[model samples]
Target: MSPAHSVLHAVFGYAQFRGPQEAIIEHVAAGGDALVLMPTGGGKSLCYQVPAIVRQRAGQGVAIVVSPLIALMHDQVGALHEAGVEAAFLNSTLDWQQTLDVERRLARGDITLLYAAPERVVTERFLGLLDDLHARGQLSLFAIDEAHCVSQWGHDFRPEYRQLTVLHQRYAGVPRIALTATADGLTRADIATGLQLQDARQFVSSFDRPNIRYRIEEKKQPLEQLLRFIEREHAGDAGVVYCQSRKRVEELAQGLQDAGVNALPYHAGLPADMRQQHQDRFLREDGVVMVATIAFGMGIDKPDVRFVAHVDMPKNIEGYYQETGRAGRDGLPADAWMVYGLQDVVNQRRMIEGGDAAEEFKAVLRGKLDALLALAEATDCRRVRLLRYFGEESKPCGNCDNCLNPPAVWDGTDAARKLLSTIYRIQQQDAGLTFGLGHLMDVVRGQETDKVRQFGHQQLSTFGLGAPYSEAQLRAVARQLLALGAIGVQRVTTEAGHAFDTLTLTAASRPVLRGEQAVLLREATAQARGKKTRRAGALPVAAADLGPDAQVRFINLKAWRAEVARAHNLPAYVIFHDATLAAIAQQHPQSIAELEGINGMGTKKLEAYGADVLRVVGL
Candidate 1:
């Protein structure tokens, strides 16, 4: 076998290349630079891993992988070690002795892959190591993971990633491959230019993860709805629940656990050891639910996560895609379920506008958030809208909530004008001292409560003009207007020194509130929401399609995987992914010959696991 194919089947457990893997590997191993854009869980690791092994075997030195995710780096090294590949990582988790050992291994050419964070890679000491390797002609390539972070326009912008351009500047001779799971055309171009990979071979794979069914729900009762969805669909499956804040993560995890969901909270505020433990348990155990803020998920390599539930919507498509991609990595059916209320929108908007990021960065963030809003308020298929954002086109998925239960389009022109007018009126009354959503909603919906009475809000011309709409309906219109840029949210400190959110009218508000522009918003009609409940059970529906014998084999395989993983101190999916086991069960192979043909079964895995798999399949 060629080096690529030899390393492919011998180290990694794969019988064939999927999508653009083979071609990309061949090009990179032949000393070509590559810019690969594959979706999350699209087997991106192999493009570099296989090539890294191939080049090393050909007498080239270690491939330097720059990754931002330390936990994920450690996991990748562990998985590679299980495959008997020579890999090590230099991140904060390593002690000085361990770091020196890894550096020594690289120096001796005993390591084929050395993973380091972008921050560590650009340090003076690390640069000296690279200089040494370059002098000896031992450098194989530079692999930049999550390359989009280098782009200012990308959501997860890291300043350290910008310094990575020095890789091309300093080591101009060595080939480089910049890979990312999510990036639009603009972000992609920025990455290419920023990393000096403009002339590299670009491989843009399909962004579709077909096994993941996308679903978005208008939030009515978020925690309750989340509980129902979890109990009904993913009761005993590995999953992730993302919230918008640390406080919310803690509350949601407490609520889920109180409701018997076996959920744990993870955020940056927690002690490092505790956070690491939560992450470790989420990875190692079966059916563990990780409730986290954005801090939790970038590098998670768990493959059997049955679902990713966003209790609060993400800031943008890149974030949403990256977060949701944490699920169903094994190629089984996974659900990307989210519930976004008007409050979620307003909260996210407040974060953007009040944040300390640069103005240009904030503008880009708003555009991305608007794209996410479009997805949330979509009347068309959610999958089509999502794919279109990434510059891909596809027919309606016929599986998303929009396809199964299309939401209603209510003309909110009058409601928007009323709400905008209310923001305008509230500001005028207090000499630009604005009020929050509750007060604004109270004034708009004709509530004669004590606060409304105390503030004399009922005297405003826009007051009670929105009586035709409920508080929820008016809030929805306000949220859409915020997204439309017709209005904005301003963070304020009251006289008592407590901070609060207030609605403010933007320049864009003039055109819409004056009846110059018509407004349309998605309203979750009672019937549509009812139908959504019926259609929301997609996972169970997919799982039940497996035959009885196949189901039994799946159960057996899962049990065996859990036991073996526990014994080896590894994740169950790392032993054998659910999709791989399903394939095994479907094939019902009676011998090692048949097991060798399985997709994830390479020489190392086949040698290490072939017999156990056959036994579980009752062969």
Candidate 2:
């Protein structure tokens, strides 16, 4: 057998490689550079890891892995140790003495894989160590994880990542591999250019995460809706709830806690220790629902997260895809749930226009935001649209909300024209004074509210033109117009110094107002009705489809595994994934020998836990 295949079985316990892993590994192991794009939970680590072991065994020496997060480095090194691999991480988590010990090991060629952050890898002291290793022919390879961070177009860009090109400049002979889970065409090009991997073999896998069910809802009583979703569908399940603001994260976390859900808040504003403690609980314990801002969940490796809910719209599809991809990493059924409204569009736009970025950068951001809006307002398959954003074509998934219960659409051309006309006439009559949605709706529907009367909008020619439409319907139309850039929002401060959003016409407004472009909108009431029929109840467990006796065995095995995990202070999956436990339970292995061929049961893990697994199965 080839060395890579041998290590795959004896060390990692996998019978075969999945997708493009084998090819990537063979190419890299033969001293070839590669850029790999694979989805999360697609066995990305193995592409670099197996080769690292193979080359190390050949006396080439230690592989240096550049990672971004300390938690990820710790978990990876711990898992490697469990697999009987000599791995160590150098990061701030280590004291001076501990750092010295790891450096000494590297010098002695005692470590097979050394993981460090980009900031540390670029330091002069670390370069000196690499120089010595290169002189001794001990630097085997360099694996850059989360490689998208090097591209400015990527969702999570780090300036430090740009400096990583030095790896290619200095170690011209050592093979290098850069990997990321999410990147569009632009981001991919930027990554290639920024890393100087223009000629490296590129491996792009399917971006589809089929296990996740995409569902987007129109926002109305968002917190209540989110609570009901959790209570009804995901009770006692580990999930993530993303918000756009720190205050909202805190509030939602407290609200979920008050409602008897085990929820915690995480954001960059919290004390470092507290953040780490919360992260530890989320990783080590079960049934934790983490409510966080965008600051959380970049390099987290928790594999059993069942749902990812967004209380506010993300600025772009890339961020949304990356955040939602965190769920269902174990390939079980999960949900990507979100609720957005007209204000979400306004808020996201205001952020883009209000930022300190250059005009060119802002334009790129606006284009990205527009793509996300299109996905949000899409009437067809959410999965198809999501994949298309990454330049991949796909048929209807038949699993997203649209395919399961297709939303009804309506010809909103006249309504959109009327809405735009109302804004125009009101602005012209009132000397360009702007109004928020409430007052705009009041004037459009001829409500004769106190504010409408005060503004004398009741006399406007366009007033009452949209009397046939409900407020929700008009809001949907307005949202579409804003998304289309036919309308823009202006932040106007009142005499009391309170700022509020007001609608204004844009260059794109002329076509709609002049009867040149037709507007199509999803029926708001139909969307609300469709939500009632969405799948509800607990997420499917690994052993859900097993026979009754096998199910019991699965439960017992899980109990045993949890105890062992606590003893080791590692995530339960680090010991054995749920799929492995289910397989053992289903097969009902009679002896340690019978457990030999089960996936994920490497030689070291089998030697350590094989008898215990058989005992649990017999129980």
For all candidates in order, the CA lDDT equals 0.85, 0.91
* Candidate of highest lDDT: 2
TM-scores of all predicted structures? 0.92, 0.96
Structure candidate 1, residue pairs in collision: none
Q: Write the per-residue lDDT of candidate 2 for residues 1-619, one digit (tens) a residue.
A: 9999999999999999999999999999999999999998888999999999999999999999999999899889989989999999999989999999999999999999999999999999999999999999999999999999999888899999999999899999999999999999989999999999999999999999999999999999878988988877788888999999999999999999999888999999999999999999999887899999988998888988989999999989989999999999999989999999999999988787777899999889989999999999999999999999998999999999989888889998999999999888888888546687788888888899888888788899988989999889999998999899998877777798977777888999999999999899988753333233223333237777788898889888888988998899898889988898889888999987789899999999999998888888887
Q: Over the stretch 170-269, how does candidate 1's per-residue lDDT look in tens digits? A: 9898999999998998899999999998899899998888888898877888889888888777777779999878999999999999998889999999
User: How well does candidate 2 score on lDDT at residue 365?
Assistant: 90
Q: How accurate is candidate 2 locally (lDDT)?
A: 0.91
Q: How many residue pairs clash in each candidate at the backbone level?
A: 0, 0
Off by over 4 Å in 2: 492-500, 526-540
RMSD of each: 3.1, 2.3
By TM-score, who's the top model here? 2
